[model samples]
Target chain A: MDKKWYWGIIFFTVAVNVIMLQLTTRAYLGREFEMVLPYSIVGVVMAGIAFFTFLQWKKVEYKEDEK
Target chain B: MSECPKSRHANKSKNDMVNLVDNVEQKEDLKFNRRAFLKSAVGASMALGLSTVPFSVRAMMGLTDDEEDRVEIIDLDQLPVGESHKFYYPTEKDQALLVHTVDGDLVAYNSECTHLMCPVFYQKEENKLLCPCHKGSYDVNSGQPIAGPPQRELPLIEIEVVNGKVYAVGRQFRHG
Candidate 1:
């Protein structure tokens, strides 16, 4: 709801994306090819959400600055 | 310091907002530290889990314990020279071909073809191991691929005959 909370959300989503990407890479190294696609997709989705939240946080910051 | 009650209330709200922002920052820092620890812990555990799995699979794939290393496949009196006994050795996952050659030498080898992991059987009439999967043929004596798509030799299992019993002692694979 607040600008601070949006920043937290961005941090969490970025973390999720990073962890998912790492898991996907590990799965590849382990020869678990079946898992690679699903984890990569999840990581990508999380990254997208994180970027969207970052934009929203920026808009809120701009509004605060204008006030 | 004769501030109005309204101004005092506004000041209190501002202090609360600052406290909230400070709390969020503190929680973010804690989360970052916790995530770092979790990342390392997860990485270590994942590495440990992946590293130990293959050994367990190999252990399950008929690499039996030492006390049970000697597999009593068939009786020497029952298996005559030039005859072959198809059985499982060390573990059920491993198929073995225990053959008594015409020269009276007892030899055994893995029954899986090296080409595509197809099951190989002793063709006693032909005196060779034949893989019906691709018409692959292997030397019964040396377990070498004689005619087939296989480029590797079949793994050999060491055999021992003591008294009237035939036992498979150990196994050796061609490593290059």
Candidate 2:
């Protein structure tokens, strides 16, 4: 639990993906085809970060009784 | 007295930090502690990220070529300066306005207000488009929202003058 970095990374991914989704919607509605790809790419990259961070967190949280 | 007979684990003690009122049981803690929170957060992030994929897909589909839709709107001589004419361009359902501004610059825009699809009127005296539904206003030349609840600019209509006739050639959504 000392490594709160896991929480930080997960939360950061959520925040970035939230913004990416909003930008994607606006661009889509405005018919800005050029902007949608970059927003979608950022969203997918943030999702990857979130998945890997969860794996790391699971390892730390479910380790054997090491006391 | 000796330790309570009802106790399941004989070694149970406050110092042991196992299954006490202040301590969570291992199985329950595993199900609803930091692990659960992180799992849910990751799920949300992944769901949100995947949600954007559809928008990208639709954007690519919308990039297809649109047919040329040139339609005669009105005669330039019929619509004098400082006056406005209402017409439909590209489609009959789309209501548009052709404005001959007081400054004599010919401009056109889809009259539907960006806020709520309410039709906006050309205020020739003030040189602005006014939406009665929400008091939204737009610049006659740029179609950008000037005030009120509207946030986006009106869709601009591309008009060309040919032999004293005004024709609507193309339309721009979310124009400046």
Candidate 3:
């Protein structure tokens, strides 16, 4: 797969994580405990996806494409 | 011939050529590579995600707090309509206000203004809460910021009227 594809997923995760952190903090401040858990869970999942996508990209990036 | 200044790998070439036809270690590609950018993005996502864990932990802890404070503030009749009674609820440190709005609705909130923690007082005439220090204001009924520098609403104190007496049962740090 192209490296840019990995970047796209990673960027999306970064964006989602930003939103999740904001919502989690807001729910925490609001004392709405029920909402915080879901937001945090989503954030963690996105982060994991980003990490795996990065590892895949790493495998591709280190190998010189030119033969 | 002298090595080309552009290529750090120029000396590595078997021939002492001024400009190497090809170099394996391309400095420009190394400096601005997709791998480096993707690594940074992954790191940022990880950091952003992990940062919320603390908040989640704290929120879980906050949920366990009991809702049975049920401290009596004053007699319902003692607080006349369109008047306010100052009280300490749940704890003496949490200064709160129980307002009998002109519309005959009972509402309560922590008197500390959301902006800069200034004390907010009821303005019966204006029918709103006012922070004198910065002129911050909140809607009397909902505790939402209405004007001035305040951006967040005051913490609301949940109250219950039990047989001619008012009791504060719980506090919500944020609400509409």
Query: Per-candidate TM vs. native?
Result: 0.45, 0.83, 0.81
Q: RMSD (Cα, Å) of candidate 3?
A: 4.8
Give candidate 2 misplaced runs (Cα > 4 Å): A64-67, B1-33
Q: Which is superior by DockQ, 1 or 2?
A: 2
Name the TM-score of candidate 2. 0.83
i-RMSD of model 3 (Å, 1 decimal): 3.3
- Sort candidate 1 into its docking category: incorrect
* DockQ of all predictions against the true structure, Cα-based: 0.03, 0.64, 0.63
Off by over 4 Å in 3: A65-67, B1-34, B173-176
Which lDDT tens digits does candidate 1 get at residues B1-176? 54333433244332323234335485556456543543443344334334433433443443333423877888999999888889887689888889887777888988888788898987777888899999999888888888968767788888888888988898766521
Report the lDDT tens digits of candidate 2 across residue range B16-63: 234444444755774776667778999999999989999998888877
Better of 1 and 3 by DockQ: 3
Q: What is the lDDT of residue A39 in candidate 3?
A: 99
Quote the positional error of residue B154 for candidate 2 in Å.
1.0
Better of 1 and 2 by TM-score: 2
Order of quality (lDDT): 2, 3, 1
Please say which candidate is ahead in DockQ: 2 or 3.
2
Q: Total clashing residue pairs per candidate?
A: 0, 0, 0
- Judge candidate 2 at residue B51 and give its lDDT: 97
Query: What's the i-RMS of each model?
Result: 11.9, 2.6, 3.3
Expressed as tens digits, the lDDT of each residue in B55-165 for candidate 3 is 888888878987547899999999999999999877878789999999999999989887788889999999999999989899999999999998888988999899999
